[model samples]
Target: MPNTPPSPRRRGTARTDALLQVTLELAAEVGYAGLSIEAIARRAEVGKHTIYRRWPSKAALLMDALHRVWTTDLDHRDTGDVHHDLREQFVRSAAALSEPPIGPVYRAVIAEAQSDPALRAALDERFLHTVEQRTLDRIALGQRTGELRADMDLTFATEILCGGLYYRHLLTTRPVDETAIDNLLDMFMRAYATDPPPPDRG
Candidate 1:
């Protein structure tokens, strides 16, 4: 007989999700430097006060958007092979980041983080930290199983692998394809793989 209204919590969640979606779209369309809370309000069909209730500043809002867009689960199956696993994971990651919606959004976030300390901290805590942990965990697992070299600095090695992806993605116009991924795996794996136990303990 009468229409039902959503609870305050549901309404708030919906509004926040709408704002995040609009924020990402606008970030891709106009870049983060060009984005404004007012523009987000207009695009999200919400009022400025509504946005303020959720996020105090543009950087805060963009950090949330970065977390929403990035920080995803990996689909690479562990075949007990580190090279194949990292290759599949990285190729999938590159392909995803090279696409339209996410590609531009990722570039914008990274660019904005350069000058924004809060944003950079957010990226480290939410995005980079998680990725680094996953990569390092995978490498450690391989080392424990003799699939990778235990002598190498896992943290630095991890950075080289993932950092190369970011460097090529943002700084260079190199095509990120299977061939590129293979080459990356080749270079890193050579240095990363464990050699036979030196014939005898020294």
Candidate 2:
């Protein structure tokens, strides 16, 4: 049988993947400050217009690249234990933000966002809002299941839960170690749980 040529959609996806991969590799090497569409095009052996046709700016391209490398599940698991599920997910997210590639690339985007309003909006819209919504969803589930207090304000709860980790990761030199996470969760449970959490099973 004759081999069928890939469709235009497949070809476009392949090209987009290549562009994103090149963006990641270059960003990893020179940092985002040194990365540019021209450099990425040169590295990918494509015209600058090829990149512009897809992404409007460096931040936009880098955001897509960051998502490509950020494989961590932002959503929570329904383990019937809200505390355990949140802890597991937080630990995974903290590790990802503290490690290389994702960590460094994300920091760069954040730094750039400080001075660029458009980039700041994009970052919040594309990344921050997604995380916050997912967290709130999990908390809402806990409330419905009687794990959390039904009267609690979920938006505030979500902020408190996620803000602690991001604060430590981004603004301070303190480590987001398990001890800190446990302490944060402990406090959150005390303030938000319907009752004290039961002792862990062996």
How many residue pairs collide in each prediction? 0, 0
Writing each residue's lDDT as its tens digit, candidate 2 over 130-201 gives 777878999998887788898999998998898877777778899999999999999999998886653443
The sequence of per-residue lDDT tens digits that candidate 1 reaches over residues 114-176 is 888887887776677777777888888888777787697998998888777666677788777
What are the models' TM-scores? Answer: 0.75, 0.81
lDDT for model 1, please.
Answer: 0.78
Q: What is the C-alpha lDDT of each candidate?
A: 0.78, 0.83
TM-score of 2: 0.81
